[model samples]
Target chain A: MKTRRSDRLVDMTNYLLTQPRKLVSLTQFAKRYDSAKSSISEDLSILKRTFQERGIGLLETLPGAAGGARFIPYMLPEEAQTFINELVDEVNDETRVLPGGYVFLSDLLGRPEILKRVGRLLATQYINEDIDAVMTAATKGVPVAQAVAQELNVPFVIVRNDSKITEGPTMSVNYLTGSSKRVEKMELSRRSLPTGSRVLVVDDFMKAGGTIKGMMSLVGEFEGTVVGAAVFAEGRVSERVVAKYTSLIHVDTLSSDGTGITVTPGNYETEVYENNNLND
Target chain B: MKTRRSDRLVDMTNYLLTQPRKLVSLTQFAKRYDSAKSSISEDLSILKRTFQERGIGLLETLPGAAGGARFIPYMLPEEAQTFINELVDEVNDETRVLPGGYVFLSDLLGRPEILKRVGRLLATQYINEDIDAVMTAATKGVPVAQAVAQELNVPFVIVRNDSKITEGPTMSVNYLTGSSKRVEKMELSRRSLPTGSRVLVVDDFMKAGGTIKGMMSLVGEFEGTVVGAAVFAEGRVSERVVAKYTSLIHVDTLSSDGTGITVTPGNYETEVYENNNLND
Candidate 1:
């Protein structure tokens, strides 16, 4: 189809956005739009500059016969801070406190916009890890994992607490629940991950980190390496078994009367910002 | 931040893509990009044309003092057919058949790209519904519902088969399992949905339609209206309890001996394509 440069720019931007972190050859674009390679190159330069200025992401151009452009979506430090601060305020609501000292986060996690922001923030931290897949437990963590996987353009595997007949052959691991301190089993289908894959673990909330630890063990069983773990929120527990993880927000305190709650920004904000600057 | 039209177009495209089916005023974009309203309008015009030509979606501009634009992401008929045809071919593998005639689909459902395509096709069916939220049963259906909900820029609520304390106050209901013909219970947190919501139920697979029917009843209990229902794939059964629903693919024959399988594009492809053409 014949198209103007303006039209090509718009289409190219949308195309790159949908397939973040994936390289697309200019020849492919040239063939699809029936445009000259020079024109496609010009369009990429425009898109790359715009993406960087607007904090949308970095558009890296690979220069060679096998070269193309790749879109790596990331959040600027200011944008990440704004998102986390807003999330902190949202989670500070007293109504979100439950009977067992747990914060009722289903409503927040269910919102696509919030999940996307949180996903971007977490995915930004590990964007350069060459992550092959994202893994999370069923129920609460699916959206978070899905969001991260979407941004990274990878598959997400859910570890279920119960074995379903439909999953076929499965690998199960028992781990202690961080809060409950009870040994619980988590299972992932054997076919979900190939051996030696690098996987990132994501969850909505973390306290004792037992679930994350369990996922680490399961990853080991699949012969996959754990790139890292991240969460939307983490409670202020004196001890955590799973270390080396990033969280967007940290719940400092939750009142028993459900009248007050305190949350603060997580430690990863500064780390992410500093790391991003160094990369640039 | 001051930005050129090239930068604004890239950012605006990203913004509109992230929040599909939601209206954004020109003033908002102008303010965000530090651009003039006329400039923003011109940028959107370029985006709208490109989006349409590329089968990305529809960009409906509302003109007036209070008007702006709404991005409705949809698949063109040919694109939809291509996606469904490819999916059918993928799911027709004999190894997917399980002992109880179930098909293993977690791998496909877990892929972000496939989920995004499935979400777009399903969301296109209800683009005009003004759906308030998407709902699904826990486990296998969460990703599908989340995908559809993300496409619609809405929240998705998961109805869990087992009620957790973290969900707070929940309403539970019992429904007959289609395959096993056993009575099973599903529960949803009361806070998940506000009263009088219009919910679209989504699931990964459907057989007897019992689960979809249960979700419909659950929506009714929440004082919400069932806008419609959608599924990734459905098993061929002579009888279905739910009459009104759409499935992208139909599993015609799952050989008990695990020798052969027949899968076909769903009945909604033509309908979706026709409706999409009408809207365009």
Candidate 2:
């Protein structure tokens, strides 16, 4: 079948979007579309420009037979700020305040649209880093970690509070959780994480940074390096054990009566701008 | 900035891919690309044909001013079968067999590529159904549920074995589990699942469907209806209780000594084909 240029362009866009961070040689595209290599190269140049102008991502091409095109997932600074501001407003609602001053965020976290945006925003910050795995605590953090991992095209590892037989053999570590000073155990399957990995820690929410700290320690046990950490939201803590991390939103206060709350965008925007030298 | 046809095509494809199941009017694309409505229509025709040919999805174009294009994700039967066979082979390994005849699936479940394929395959089955929400058990089932929810573009609700205050007031139910006959409690937040919602239940694995049944009961407690249930893999159970469900893989045997195991593609392919009248 003779494939038209328009058809080839559409199919190529879909291919690149689905295969993010995967390299596809011009020969591969040429063979798949039954077109000349020159035609495929022209198609890719159009894709690259469109993607960049739309803030979809960066379509990087490497010259020579050993190289090809790779789609690096990214989010523009303006778009990232807009999304974070919207997220902050939605999270600032008094209705989301639960008992014990904990804010209900599962609703937002469960939305694929919200998760995708959060994933792109967070993943963009680590695009230049060599991240082997995205790690998170079980239950709540699973969605966030999965989202970020999808953007980075890497597998995510879920650390559990309790071991399950279904996980086979596991390696565990103990850490103190919260100001309550209660010790908690976190474990991961022995084979889930390989040694000497570069890990990115993610969580749905952080308070006192105990869980994040525990994940970092667990990573160390595997002889892995913590590339960085990010959380969807952060709560007030007198002394956060984890000093360096990125967050999308910070909850300033929540009334004991659960009728009032305040939230603002986290250091994510600032960090992203500083790292990439993105202008306001 | 005068928009070129190639740039418009690439941008339109990205827009449609990102906004699955969304009704995007031609005017939206036309305005976004600074192109004429007729040109946008031509671009969509190319996209529609290319999307169909590539098996990326079905680009449905609705007529009239109120009508527009909707991207319904799908998987070709041959592609689905190939993926399932690969998955079956990967899962049949003896190393995955754990104590108590349970298979270690967390590693596969944690993989974004595997999860994305599983999500699309399962979501394709319920594409025509009106699924308002996707529900799952806490811990293990969260990833599968999130992936499916992402494909369907709906919010997912996590049913927990134990209640957390962060989830707010929840509705709970007790269901008898396994041959052990232990009654276990399952709960979901009151606000997470609205009354009379049409929910799809998803899980990583199903032994005897006790957990799925528990999720169904919890859904009922919230006055919601279960549209369907799907599991990544299903194990043998004498006189299966939940008669109606779809599974991607069937674990026929796993030696108690954990040395040998056998697996096969489940009724998923058969059902999908029969439902769609797809030929081999």
Candidate 3:
């Protein structure tokens, strides 16, 4: 259809990134630059191939009837750190979150860039695992799980405090929320996962292993395997997990005066490799 | 190096999908199949091309040092429905969600299969929209955003109500949330988007377009253009914008009647034609 060979990819890539949350297929991109679809496909082929060379961005395309390619500008941790640092500055509002010991990021969980970067960093570590699915509890954890699930190229399932719209009946377990004052019930579709599926459970916070345990019980009911468990933040009873996993940041609220947060290996690409023997 | 026969693209594709999150170098896949990197590359070339042709999956390959190939398995709506329907049936908590006038889908959002299917379906329509990036508010919306991001090969950004430790500092805004009782503050980072960028915003709910307005404002602050905005469910007070969009399901909630939901055009793929319109 159309063609622009000289520096088309970089410009096209930039053009696509400038318009996040939309799609621009091969034919359209071809027509935009005045190149043939085959030639444009060649350009996309180069762009997509280059993505895996570095741990950033993905070029996805659909096939047949309504098919075209779109570019996802995913940032590697090195790239992600810049934004994370900026976000932390906003979170420095110590007074508002002091009562809870941390800012309630439940609201922030809905933002896209932060979650995309964070999720990729986590997924960059676990891409080779026998990860059957990404699991999380309601509200906050969904974003994190979705990011990781995307990075891992697997499915993500959510657990709930109660039955709500969008689902039928569920299999649930009691969980003592870390910051909240109640024993919340977490539920999953009994038939969603098959028997002996390998699952990785994740959440935004884990003060006690209570929520983790509850999810573990839910997994147990389905005869699924809890291959790993993780959290974006950990507080108070950090060491209470029934097993070991990863975390991007560790919130050690244990030592009364020294209550602080330190990032952990769980959040890094190294942990994913080490745990899955990826480096081997 | 490794390589398969001319038509063994499917096997190669599956082998890569089963591997998940790992970056498989050209040498690795080449060696596994006993083919030259060039030959493997050709196969991958075919795999990526044909995989999309079959509407089965995507192949993203990293070039140069520390690079490899990754396959993400996804399906269009027609294929995903039956599989997801079974899972939906298992989640048969019809009673609990009636109060919210919705099904309790907080958990299904986390399931990998459901997310994979839904994300792919929604992404098909926008795949050729020349989208720059994929945007979604946090929590439950993350997975949906991730699936779309992966399918489109773009970055997904998450906004927040309040910044967390993971995020250092942030750009803040007070937007009206869904149909909640009050207006909630939403936050994003200044550098998360490029000025004059085109962004697509996706979310799980759209009660009043309050938070969406805030996100639109956030896009404005970045000098970015909103290419489109969509939600999985309809909001309380709906207003049409330049790119106002809905999803597979629409939620209509009245003060007296409460909530009503229906499926929409978010499923079927958008038709894109080959611009064979050439010289006279």
The CAPRI quality class of candidate 3 comes to incorrect
**lDDT tens digits by residue: candidate 2, A160-188:** 99778789999999999975689999999
Task: Compute each candidate's TM-score over C-alphas.
Answer: 0.95, 0.97, 0.53
Question: Recovered native contacts in candidate 3, as a fraction?
Answer: 0.24
Q: Which stretches of model 3 miss by more than 4 angstroms? A: A1-135, A138-140, A143-200, A204-280, B2-49, B57-97, B100-104, B129-132, B162-165, B177-182, B189-197, B235-243, B251-280
For model 1 the local lDDT of residue A118 reads 76
Writing each residue's lDDT as its tens digit, candidate 3 over B109-162 gives 655556666666565455435566666775567777766765555566778775
Clashing pairs in 2: none
**Runs with alpha carbons beyond 4 Å of true place in candidate 1:** A64-66, A253-259, A274-280, B1-3, B64-66, B253-259, B274-280
For residues A1-280, could you state the per-residue lDDT of candidate 1 as single tens digits? 6678878888898899889899999889888889888888888998888888778888999875466899987888889878889988888887888875778899999999998887777778876788999999988999999999999899999999989988999999999998768988999998888888999998988998999999999999998899888888888787899978888888865446654578888777766775553222
DockQ of each: 0.83, 0.86, 0.13
Rank candidates, lDDT, best first.
2, 1, 3
Return whichever of 2 and 3 wins on lDDT: 2
Error of 3 at A273 (Å): 10
lDDT of each: 0.86, 0.87, 0.58
Interface RMSD of each: 0.9, 0.9, 10.3
Candidate 3: tens digits of C-alpha lDDT, residues A1-280: 3333433553454445434324677667766677767777666566566554444466676664246776554546556555545555544443324333554454345454466666766654554456777778765677787777766656677777766454555677776665454768778866456667788888887776678788888888878888777787655553464556566554433234433434333343336533443322
Place model 1 in a CAPRI quality band.
Answer: high
Native-to-model Cα distance after best TM-score fit, residue A125 in candidate 3, in Å: 13
